[model samples]
Target: MEAQHTPDEKIVKIEKTILRGTRPRSIGYNARKGTHGPCITDVVVRLHTDSGAWGIGPANISQEKAKGLLGSKINEIFKLPFGAFGEGIKLDLPLWDLTARILNLPLYRLLGARGKRDVQLYDASIYIDDLNLNDRQAVSLFKEEVYSGIEHGYHNFKIKVGRGSRWMEPKEGIRRDALVVRTVRETSPAGSKIMIDANMGGTLNSTLELIRLCAEYDLYWFEEPFAEDKLLNLALKSHLIDSDSKLLIADGEFHPPNYFFELVEEGLVDVVQHDFSDYGITWWRSTAAKLESWDALCAPHTWGSYIERYHHAHFAASIPNYALLEASPGKMPGIIEDGWEMKNSRLHVPNTPGAGITIEKKIFDQGLDDRSAFSLSI
Candidate 1:
C-alpha cells in the first residue's frame, strides 16, 4: 500500500500594499471617468505560508476580511467556495500563487496552459474625449500616438469613443468619435487592427451610428456599446452591424462564474474581455476553457501597473484564442524586477514560476511613505 504524506504548509499571513503614483503622460481623458490627468491609486497583496513560501497578487481586499484564512490548512482554504468572505478575486489570486509554488510549477502551466514566449499586445491610446483637444486637434493627437505605437512595433490599437464628457458638447462628441476612427484607420500601417471601446458611455442610438461609421474603416471590434444589463440589445446590435465588425464586451470580471458562462452560452458578444485581477487564477482558468469550447475569444483587460500587466501577459501567452493583450504601460517604471519590454509589438512571457515577476522592494518601501500607503497583516 502507498503511504500518504501530509502537506506541510498553511497560509499564515496576508498583506495588502497601497501604492500611489502618477499616470503616464501618454494616457488621455475618459469623459465617463471625468478625470483630466489622474493620479494612480492601487493595491498589491501578498500571502505567506507557514512553510515560508510566499505569493503576491494585485487587487485590494480588506485585511480583516482576509484574516479568515489564518490557522486554516492550505487544502482547507482551497476547498472553500470562491468569494466566501466577499473578498472576490483579490483572495483567489494569492491562493493560486501559493498552490502553484507549492507544486513547483508556473501558474499558467498549473492551469493547464502551455506558455507562449511572445504574445501580441495592443496600445490603448486615442481617447476621444481628451478635454484638452477639439475634434481636429484630437484627430491630430491620435495620429501622433498611433505613429508612436507603430514605432514601438504595436500593430493593434484601441481607441475610446462616445466622448461628450462634462467637457465636450454632445454634437462635438459624435463628430470626434467618427473622426477618431477615420484618423486611426488612415494613419495606421496596412493591416493594422483598430478597436474602439464605448465603455457603456454611448447611448444606443449614438452607438449604432458609430457602428455604422466604423464599418467603413473595417474596425476590429466595438466594446461595451451599452451596459452589461443590455445583453439582448447588444446581441441585436451585433446582428445589425457589419458582419465583419466584432462586438467585444467585458463580463465576468470581479463576479461569480454563473453570469460569465451565461454570457458565453447566449452568444451575446464575439469577444469577451476578462480581467485576471477581477477573476483570479482558478475561475479564469475554467472560464477560458469554456470560452474555447464555445469558440469564443478572450482578450485580457490590462489596466493596472507593471505587475498586473505581467499577470495578464502570462494568461494571454497560455491561451491560443487571444489575439491581443490590452496594455497601459503607465508612468511608474522600475516597480517590478522583470524587465518588461515590447519587442515586435509583443511581450515575452516571464519563464519564472508563479506569476513570474518580482515586486521591487524599494518601490514598496517608497510607497510606504505615501499617506495612502497601508499594509494588512495577520
Candidate 2:
C-alpha cells in the first residue's frame, strides 16, 4: 500500500530566474507612460522542498528576505483558504503553486471552484497608435490591430484614450479618441464588447464628452478616466445614469486608498481591477467576497505578464463576481504551459495541478545567462 505524505514539507532551496520576452508588436504610448517597448522582463522564483516536491511562479523577492525563509515548513508559510501570512506574503504566488501541487489539485479547485472554468477576457493591447499617423492611417492601424486580436481569438477589446492629456491638443485628442472608439465599434463584429481606459488622464468634462460622442456605440466600461476621487466617481455614475448609458466605471488598479471599497459599497464603482499579481490570490478571493455584497465585480488588472494572466484565469475561475480579465496577448519564451485553452474571448482554465505551467530547464538556463538570476539554499 502507498503511504500518505503530510503537509509538513520543509523548504530546502529557492531558485530565482529572469525571463525576457517580446510582445506581438511594439506597444505604443498610454495617457502617462511612454512607449511600452516590445520586450518584457519578469522575475520568477522556484521553491524546492525536502520531499522532492517543487513549485514556481513570477515573484521579485530579494535574496535577503528570501534567505530567511530557507528552512521554514510549507505549512508555516502558506495555508489553504487564507493563503500566505506574515513574512510569507512576499512568496504568495510560489507558495500557492506549491501547496496546490502538493495536494494534487488545480489551483481553481483549491480555491473552491465557485465559478466557471472558462472565464471571459478582453484584449488589453490596444494603445494610442495614432500619435504620428494621419487620421486615415491611424484608423487603418487600429482596424488592423483589432482584426489581429480577433484572429487571435479575442471578441472584446480595451482601447486606451486620453491622448489629449499627454500627446495631442485637448480637443483633437478627444476627437481622435472618439474616432478610434467608433472605428473599433464599427469594424468589430456585432456583439463585440469595447472598453476604454484613460489611465487617470482625463477630466470629468472630457470623459462625459467622449461618452456623448460614442453613446450609440455600446461600450462595456470606462476605466480610470481620472484619479480616484469619490465626488468625481459619484458625478460620473450620476451622469451615466442620467444619460441612460450602460457604461460601467472601472478603477482601483493603482492600489487606491481604503475608501475605494466604500465607493464599491455605495455602488459608485461598477468594476474593481486591483492587479492580479500585486494583490495576490488571497486578496482577490476576499475582495471578491466583499464586492459580492456591494454589487460590484472584479476584473483584476493583468496587463504586463502572460504568466500573470494565467494566475488571473485561475482566480477568475474560482470567483463568482469576476467581471472580465485583461489580456496581455503575448508569449513568454522558456515557459511551457498546458491545459488552458482560449476559444473566442474566454479562457478555459486547465484542470491540471499547480497552475498547469512549467519551465523548460534548457531554455530557462540559456536565457538566464544574459538576464538577472540567483539562488538560495538552507
Candidate 3:
C-alpha cells in the first residue's frame, strides 16, 4: 500500500494581535497579592496558510522567531499525536489549531478525545473581598459572591484565604479566613464544592490552624497554603490523614521548582496546577501522562486569559485524570467564540474545529490600527 499523503499547505502569513479582557467584577486581594484590576490584555498569534486555513492562540515568542516560520509547511512544522517539533514547539497552540482545522476535527478530538466533552468548572473569582469590611459585611459580600456564581451556573467556588499574611493581625486574619469559608459554605447550594488558596502566604502552623477552623465546612482542596516544601507538604498531608479530612493538597502554580514532581511522586500533592498558558498544551500533554501514572490529578491554572481558559477546557476534555477547571467568567472583546455553554456547573467544550473561536474582522482591523501587530509573509 502507498503511504498516505498529507496537506502541503505552507504558512503564508502570520499576524500577532492584542485582545483586552474585562472581568465582571473587580478582583480583590489574595493571600499575598494586591487587587487584581478589572481588565487584562492578551497577545495572540495567528497563522494563515496558503490554503486559507488558519489558527490562533496565546503568543509567547518574539516577532523575529515568528518571522522565521513564515515559509514553513504545515506538516513540516506540526504533526498529530506528537504536536509541534523543534522550533515549532514555540507555536504549539496555533499549530495545533491549524492542524485540527485541516483535519476538520475539534481540538479535543484531534487530541484523541480521551475524556468527556462536558468538562467540570469551578468559579475562581472569590477573593479576599473582606479587607475593609466588618465581620457581618464581609460575610454578606461572601454570600453575595457565592449566590452570583450559582446564578451563573458555577457550583464550585475557590475562596482566597490567608488574610493574616499581609492585611491583618495574624489571629484576626485566620479568623476572617475561616469566616469567609463558612459563609460561602452556608450560602451556596448543597453539594457545592469549596476550595481555598493561600498563595503561599501562610506558615505551616497557621495553615494547620486555619484548616482546623474550617474543618466542618468540607473544603475540596487547600491550595498553596505555603510554598512547596517536602517536609511542610508531608506534614500537611499527614495532618489531613490524621484528621481524616478529605481536602486535597494542591500546589505548583507559582513557578514550580525542579523538585515539584518529586513531591507528586511521593504522594504529597493530590493535584498538579501548572499554568496552562505559560507551559503550553504540549507540556501539559506529556505532564498529564506522567501524573496519571503517579495517581495524581491535573487541573492546569487558568486565571488571566479567557483564551487560555478555553485551552484548558480542551485539554481537560482530552485527559482522563483531569480535575475541574478554574473559571474566571468575563468577556473578551474582539473574539467570537461558539458552542461554549455553561450548564449544571460544567463548561461544554465546543465540537467546532480550531479551538471554536474566530477573531472578529472589525476587532482585528482595530488591533491592526496601532501598527503594533507583527506580520510576515512569503
Candidate 4:
C-alpha cells in the first residue's frame, strides 16, 4: 500500500452525523460509575476528498463545521490539535479509509493485517442489576440472560458483578456476587468461558472475598475489580489475587492508550480492553503490537451499532493474541442494513472496501425527522 500522498490529494468536505434514536436499553450496571444509563449515541464521520472519493467511520469526535476541513490535505488535517478539531485521533479512521480506497486497498491491508480472521466474540449481557429482584430473583434473571447467550452460539459470556447499586447492601452484595458466579458456572456449557467485570466498584477486601468464593468455577478472567484511577491498589490487589488463584485479570477499557501501558507495565492486568473508536485504528495497530511484546492479550472493548462492530472485527483480524471480541447484546435496529456476519459465535472479518459499512440512510433520516437523532454541532 502507498504511504505517501500527492500534493493534489486534499480533503474537501467533512460531514458528521449524530445518531440518537436508539431507544434506551438498560445494560448491566457499570460498577465503576455505580449506575447505568441511556444507550450510547453514535457519531458517523465522512471524509470527502478532492478525488470525489469518501471514507466513513464511527468516531467520538464532533464536526459541526465542514468548511474548517475544506481544501486541506488529509494528512495535514490529522496533524492539527484534536481538541481544537472537536475530534480525537480516531478521525484518522475515515482518512485512512479514504486513503486506502484511493489506493484501491482494504483498510486492513493498509494496517498490515491479512484477509478476514475468525474472531471469538462474546455477548456482554448478564448484568446483576435487576432492582426488582432479591438475591434469588437476581440469580434467576442472570441465568436466563446467560442461557439466551448460550443458545445464540456464544462460547464465552461476561456478567457484571460488584453489585455497585445501593439496592443491595454490603453483605447482601457480596452474597449475591458469589451466587451469580456459581449460577453462571452451573448453567454454562462445561468447556465454555465465563468472565466477570467488576467495573472498578469493589473495595480491595470485598473484591478478594468475592473472587475466592467464586474462584472454583474456572473463570476465564476477572475484569476491573477495582476503580481504574487507583493504579497502586489495582496492581497490589491483582498481584495478590493472581498469586492466590490463577484468575487472569482484565481491564484498561476506560484509559487512553498511553495510560493503558501503565496497567501492563505495573502488572495490573492480564488482558487489556481498549476501544479503537476512542484512540483510532493506528493507535490500536501499534498498541496491539506493544501488548504482544509485554506478553499480554488485547481484547478491544466494543459497544455501539453494527458499524462499530465491523471496525472492531477489521482490527481484530490483525492481533495474534486477541482474547475475545465484546458484543453488547443491546443494539439499535436498522442502523446497518447489511455488513459482516456473526456466525457460530465468531465475528467474521468483512472484505468490503473502505470500512465495509453500509449505513441505512433512510432509517437515519427517519431518526433525524423525528428529532430522535442528536446533532453534535461544533
Task: Show model 4 residue runs off by greater than 4 Å.
Answer: 1-8, 20-25, 32-40, 64-66, 78-90, 114-116, 151-153, 164-166, 228-244, 255-260, 304-306, 335-339, 367-378
Reference-based TM-score, model 4 = 0.82
Lowest lDDT sum, 10 consecutive residues, model 2, at: 1-10
Residues forming the 10-long window of minimal summed lDDT in candidate 3: 1-10
Which pairs of residues have clashing backbones in candidate 2? none
- Which tens-of-lDDT digit does each residue in 140-227 have in candidate 4? 8877777777776776788788774344677777778788888888888777778888777787777777877886888888887776
Global fold similarity of model 3 (TM-score)? 0.95
The per-candidate count of clashes, in order, stands at 0, 0, 0, 1
1-378 in candidate 2: lDDT tens per residue? 122233679999988888878878999999998889787777778899998999888787887888899999987877766888888888888888888899898888887788888888888899998899999998899999988889888989999999999899999999999999998998887898899999999999999999998898899999999988889889989988887878999999886877888888988898999877777887778889989888889988878877777777888888788888888567788888888788989889998998888889986676456435767787
Local distance difference test scores for all models = 0.65, 0.86, 0.85, 0.66
In candidate 1, what are the lDDT values of residues 28-88, reduced to their tens digit? 5654665435455567777777788887767566655666656666666463322112343
lDDT of 1 at 103: 66
**lDDT (Cα, 0-100) at 98 in candidate 1:** 65
Candidate 2 vs 4: which has more lDDT: 2
What pairs collide in candidate 3? none
